[model samples]
Target: MAERKHDRKFVRTFFTTPTAVEGEEDSAKMLRGAVGLRGMKAPDVWVPDNEDATAPSMRDEGAENIVEVVAENGADFPGEIHPRVVWHRDSPATRYQGFKHMLQISDPERGAIEHIDGFVIPEVGDIDDWKKADEFITIVENEHGLEEGSIAMSVIIESGQAELAMGQLREEMGKPTNNLERLFLLVDGEVDYTKDMRAITPTGALPPWPELRHNTSRGASAAGLIAVDGPYDDIRDVEGYHERMTDNQAKGMLGIWSLTPGQVVEANQSPLPPENGSWLLDVGGRKVELESEDGVEIYDGNRLSLEETGDGYVLRVGGDGRELDEDELREELLDMTEYVPSMDDIVDSMEEFEAAKEAGRGAIAITQSATLRIDGVEIDVNKDRMWDEATYQAAMTPITLFQDVYRNRPDQHEELAEMYSEDVVERAMDVGA
Candidate 1:
């Protein structure tokens, strides 16, 4: 069937970093470089299943920098999930941050994690997919020693089926428990999604994929779930990867997948829009310079102000006014300015994200549950959950089982707003608008 224009759009840019366990040398290099990321914050490492997950233990390097360790079941439980993961003899490593399996939310990993944070579910195309996920979760708790809603389950929106199923999916979001807390949207399952959209006419480079990406993001935003961007496989294409990530950032993706150590700096970077700058304007080809105090108005309308600091000249905007949302703006500014992190050290990229967060510029990532305003719209987001209202109501589940930080504390609002800002949030809200 043909698609419509009013599809849901992606809100936050999510970078689901994937590393191929093949070729020991390359994997090691990627891991080493990733660990050395400027801010010392490691990228969200995705160690897929059907690989050498047990041996070598990528756990050490991944210990600190890891955000969410997604054991993608797609590689093993391909096409569709059947009941639950067979849970081979192996599969350990519990001490990572936000550790969970990425099986289809429709089915449980059974004994995958008797006590763990979360799991993954692929190709969540519609309400039925979630309904099936709900059923599967029930089976796990009743028969497999799986505590109801004890583990957080996430969803991946790949393929045309999930796109078509968006409307219905929204209606059935929380499920029988209303305890369903968070939904993790996999970055790019469209590699498989395009295959599913076979019936639709090929719409050139940006087919159902981009639209599908936009829709999933919007759905997640509306539902207050986390939407991650798909991985960029072509590793060596450094500049190309940055450009693609820039595109995703434009779409307001939370974080982009980091394939190699080199890409980490780029992924950690927030969009550099020149809302206020003579330097940025010049970099953007506007060639504007401040001659006198009267020239300050050159950046009028923009909430930016030019100042100096230990790190060369700094452009600080009063509110969140934006200038250039393109690489030329940042590149030109970086080239024109004497910002630190020198030529030999890419520390600028590493420290830039953290620095931005500290300056109240934007969020490093959506590390917790908070309300995000994308384009003046408020989105209530939570990163954890229980199984369902039915399960909770039946006393089969514990309401306070998951670690959600704070549940509606008035004081935390300001802190959360600073963590996940509107710049990143606004990216997706403006989709199609």
Candidate 2:
């Protein structure tokens, strides 16, 4: 069989920093220098200073690629320039100050989907509050007409609650919206197992084992979450770091942030191969022998021969096996492969997965479960489903899961909007309209 090819997409990093009028030219020079070093053009530049003078100055200095200007505390800028630049107000206490800023300009109708960053704010509190935060997110989504996969929500998981609520956070943020597309759980700051217990135990329960110091909380439910220790920490040599990240991908997280250039290069280079192998097929309780060109063959009582069909291969089973439907037989064969695991591969995969899982647990523990109700479902730390390797990978890469969810449960979009407040709704409308 020919090897399957996987294409990796590179995400551009938008750097954010405060600029001063005196240092405007120097700032532009530094930015251009940084751009040169990163081997890319600047996507957007955030001028934190609220003064109107700096915006025009930066614009005049050949920083024409600057897409938006962000200010803290809702400070307004001069109205002389293009209305394309958006203004956003955010609390300094939240971890997503930069994300909220970029989201203001993220309008799918305008074809403005770009990767951006938000400064990580260190805030401490109950991890359960992420549910309410999810509610706040819904408000933002409703107001802005944000839809799932429209704009990515990258939360800096600095607190215990932030880390604990990652799963639920992703789920809530991932609700279908007009503009939203991806949700990223970024574990920023120092990876302190003691202080940030939310990463260790997302559910608000005592440690599963007494020996485990960290208890679980509500925030750790979403699978798309990824944890990088911190900007200051050494990026190259963290324990179980790659597995923790891959585990997040397994859960549904697409990407992580705050990584240095070297770290980013390493992550993009990791190998992920498809699980492939041969398996025995039992069709309608009848067995058959299928042979591969590679000389690998499994035999059952029923005789099966492969005949070349136009543009495809067909299996003639049971000799007189009533001319099988081609589509049905193909489906059955695919299903059979999943059930029959290659013992050698499974053993090797499990060994690596176990080591990574233990390291992930040591660095950050996840608690997850699920419940179904006719009226509505309630998900939290205690009520959530724990993520095994497979589930973790699925949650981390939400593009895949989002497609699945939209196909499976199209009606859940409205429920997602109801979680937000009026302010968010108004903001969403202002931008989208």
The best candidate in terms of TM-score: 1
Model 2 agreement with the true structure over 1-433: per-residue lDDT tens digits:
1111111121212122222234544553432333332211211112222112245444332222323222111122110011112112224333243234334434334332232222222332333343333334445456667552322333344455544454344334434431222333343433433444543557642232211111111232324233332332345664444654454454333233323445443342222222233434455465333443333344433354444445544555555433335555445345433222222233333344456676775222332121211112111112123446664453333223323222332242343234333433233223211
Q: For model 1, what is the error of residue 426's alpha carbon versus the real structure, in angstroms, after optimal superposition?
A: 24
Residue 196 C-alpha lDDT in model 1: 66
Model 1 deviation from native, Cα RMSD in Å: 17.6
Model 1: per-residue Cα lDDT over 72-190, one tens digit each: 22222111111112121112232111122222222344332322234455545455555455455555545545455554455555556666665454565555554344344434566
| Cα error, candidate 1, residue 252 (Å) | 2.7
> What are the lDDT scores of the predictions, listed in order?
0.38, 0.33
Candidate 2 accuracy as lDDT: 0.33
Worst 10 residues of 1 by lDDT: 396-405
